[model samples]
Target: MATDAVKKYLEDTNRPYSCADVTVNLRGAFTKSAIQKALDALSEAGKIKCKLYGKQKVYAAIQHDNADGPSENEDYDTPIKTTTIELEELNTQLKTKEASLKSLLAAPTSDSARVQAGEIKTNIEKLESRLATLRDSVEVMSADEKRGILESHAKLLSEYKKRKRICSEMIEAMLEGYPKSKKNFLEELCIETDEMVDFKLVSFQV
Candidate 1:
């Protein structure tokens, strides 16, 4: 007749907790005939509380406040309490709230209001287009004036090609003077600096 065995039976609602639930968990010293006797003993000891729901009489364990204290039903501010909320009631509330939220979000805004909003967006986009065009014209004019002032800035690739040509001529002259034959330039350049082809990899940008 352990209090702990009765406590386990009352806590889990999914399992069909009964006298069998107690006896099976206890394993020893608890026989089928003794199941009723255990419940009676726990009830008489005031270590259990029960509530009626539908056809089932659900029991819960009561915690003892103090050894010297009177039973939990005494005039103490804090007494042992157990709450069993009805599943049906909770389910009904959940469905009602779900329906209400669905209705609220699904309801359409006023037709006139939506049209006005679209018109306002169109006006904003038109203004932004004009602003962008004006900005582009200003940048082009500024670039032309700067180009006129600084003709010193030359194309970097033009100077690089000229230098490469001069180097090649000098290298050919030196190699021609050597008695040994020069290595093939075509095979080395083809393998080392081949042109890049189209390819893609995973990337993200702002």
Candidate 2:
């Protein structure tokens, strides 16, 4: 489906389009990676032509005329591939295993075999739940939302590192005059927010 969307978008456009441009236009429908995959597929199918410009890959739709002959790769439209339903088969297998496990659990007395069956059932349940969660996520999640979350996490980590660096610098300055062996100095080095604040205030006075 994404490949078809990409083809259509390129067909409508007069100039070449980059993966980022296609991804932005598609937005919630497909991710940047997905768009690139589609672009690769289109290139392979000869529906599009790719040219490298510096570090970027740009794609242009192949033009064809009704009266003209076909190129090496036919420039005719093809059916858009749809997502497969292999997950349905997995669900059926999981259900069968769950029923068998239930029967084993209903047996009169506990045995090693039953214990193994229970463990198997727990594993199956975990796998089934995980697959279901993934399916749901794929259906509802957007690439932009995921990127935003990642960007926020990276920003927080950057700020944390900067703060730690400032504190380390302040602590190292404070110990400049202390007489101690390098090993002992490194082992004793510790930096805290209050100490950093004090160091900044002292620096201001000097």
Candidate 3:
């Protein structure tokens, strides 16, 4: 949805985009890695200006005004918005997980199992509803707003990617010829989105 808003802004204002600029436009949070990915994507497709500014890189919408700093990637775009393309891709992720979540409905041979299946379905439905709401909100933000959110996200992602990369390289060197690297790698990956949140009700004794 932020993607759509970004596209619309670019089309209407004919403004060039940078990762920071896009972040502001999308108003959604993205990690530094995510920003880099988006910047690389837009750069490759000829949509934005991405340049290395000494210590850091600068990004902006393409063909509007060139930064005085040296340019690393010369890419700009037409009216085509890859955000739409991205949404389709994200949709595939949801679809792939849908079956896994829904697969619990197999006729339960036990009463407890039947309740478990119902509980899973209920949780799944709630998750879906929250996702739908967030998606719609993302879709509706203005390009400037989107850009701000993206900028914040990019800042986060940049740090995250740097740390992850370092951790991975260190692991690679430390664990050379050692087994279980795959598990470690996955644990690292799942640290953010894979953890299950648990809650409980308890009576406090006074």
Candidate 4:
């Protein structure tokens, strides 16, 4: 019964779906394992199509007449294009905001601007004191020790950037057919980007 239901769903939709997607769309009519088995049987019987994209397997109904139709991967690629454009727009906005912030900090004409400037000054004094304490507690290092530290920092930074990139791509893919904008989704999840925190990853000179 699940096999028939899944087969009919795929044929009617004529779109690719992952196992998790099928399970969610089915409204829990069948267990995920049962749905997966149905998908696999249909794929093996040539009633449906299955392809591995990255680590995930996606299935679609075989179309006989629509040979010139869009590829299944287009569903994933379309979101990526939209997300890229949105990111570019957001970057432009960020630059404008940064310039405005610099102007406010330099002038401090309004009450809010003056308060913010004062807070920033306090933060700077605290950071300077912390840095002095740290410097006093640390001993001078040899050239070899300094080089090793720099090499370790570089390796960690590379891994961090790689992981962040992978995560961003995955999120972009997941944004397909999502109801809300990427900014709203991230806000709901309380996720912060590097730009939000004014953080940047830079290579350490060894």
Candidate 5:
């Protein structure tokens, strides 16, 4: 009976849930191990889909040929809400970093300018790391979910390109102003030159 209810819940929602999630959603209607058993049985019977997301197992209700997948009445936004939030956050951080970089570039070179440049570099590195993480997260999403996120974020993608162009220009400016040693340092960091930085890899358009 609990297994049927669990299957119904998955079918109605059309989303994946971890075992812990299933236990919480069921709210003591079934023991955690019991729910796990049901999920295993469902997977074996082709009644549900089960896969590992990282180290954790997740289950989603299987959609049959005749069954409706996502209904017209269903909330489409619910599926990619986390991705939306992440993109918004990334846009905000990118904007902040862009402003900082612009400001750093506008100021005349001084000890303070060098320190600001270092800080900007660190922030950019962190942003790149976040971008790589976002890409990985997107890869895990279903094709439709990934398409939805990319379509909704077209403007964000444009902003990224604009910012990349700005950064490239700023790097050229820095190379012109800084000594040879600074150029060597940048090369060692694999940045090499302003022209060498491949903006396409980080572009959301890609």
Candidate 6:
């Protein structure tokens, strides 16, 4: 049976062997699962000693001391303990790396961010183009044009004042013996002046 074969190998070697080591050393005499089961059974039966070195189970033959000295297996315990502690620290670091990877996976991908950046850039370019067009379309008055406009405004204002004075004088003469006051007679005639509607005539300066 494979269990007998495994047990014989352990007793003959009289040294520690992990399941993987035994599988390789056995040269395909037994499948890995069969060797593992055999190792477990032998350890449970106290036919061999099993110690866990980190995540791996190592089996050794049960040592018996001779009358001359202690068995060699007695020397393995200290090194195994040190190796276990180191493996535990490595496992902790590996777990931390895995958590970081998971968090990165949950966030937005680089491709998506690039696509959004491209859209924002396109919108900004369009707005800049529109602003440039509006600036170009606006008309700027030259100094000569501004002066001409001011002169035209002054002339029209002077003509308007002259016409208003003439009309006021004619009205006053006609209202000399009128029953109502001049202001009242003007209101009855539904006449509106610039001052009545709070209108201001402002002069332009070049």
Specify the highest-TM-score model's number: 6
In order, candidate lDDTs are 0.57, 0.71, 0.60, 0.85, 0.77, 0.86
Counting clashing residue pairs in each candidate, in order, gives: 0, 0, 31, 0, 0, 0
lDDT by residue (1-206, candidate 4, tens digit) is 99999998987887778899999999999999999999999999998878775567888877666656675323444544465578689999999999999987787468877899899999999999999988897557788999999999989998998999998998899789779999998898898999999997778788
Please give me the total number of clashing residue pairs in predicted model 1. Answer: 0
Q: What TM-score does each of the candidates earn?
A: 0.27, 0.32, 0.23, 0.35, 0.34, 0.46
| lDDT tens digits, residue span 1-206, model 1 | 45555555544432334565567766765676676666667767775665444564544555454476665433211221212345567788999999999997787669867998899999999999998998878455576666754443344445755776787687678777666544555344452221234433322221
**What is the Å distance of residue 106 in model 2 from its true position?**
77
Choose 3 or 5, whichever is better by lDDT: 5
Error of 6 at 51 (Å): 3.7
Candidate 4: regions farther than 4 A off: 65-206
User: Residues 133-153, candidate 6, lDDT per residue (tens digit)?
Assistant: 889975678778888999999
- Per residue, candidate 5 scores C-alpha lDDT tens digits across 62-170 of 6565346555233434444564568689999999999999998998789887999999999999999998998778357687887788776886777877987897788
Model with the higher lDDT, candidate 4 or 5: 4
Summing lDDT over every window of 10 consecutive residues in candidate 6, give the lowest-scoring window. Answer: 65-74
Question: lDDT for model 2, on a 0 to 1 scale?
Answer: 0.71
Q: Kindly give the stretch of ten consecutive residues in candidate 5 with the minimal lDDT sum.
A: 72-81
Relative to the unseen true structure, what is the C-alpha lDDT of residue 3 in candidate 3, on a scale of 0 to 100? Answer: 40
Worst 10 residues of 3 by lDDT: 197-206
Q: Give the backbone clash total of model 2.
A: 0
Candidate no. 4 TM-score:
0.35
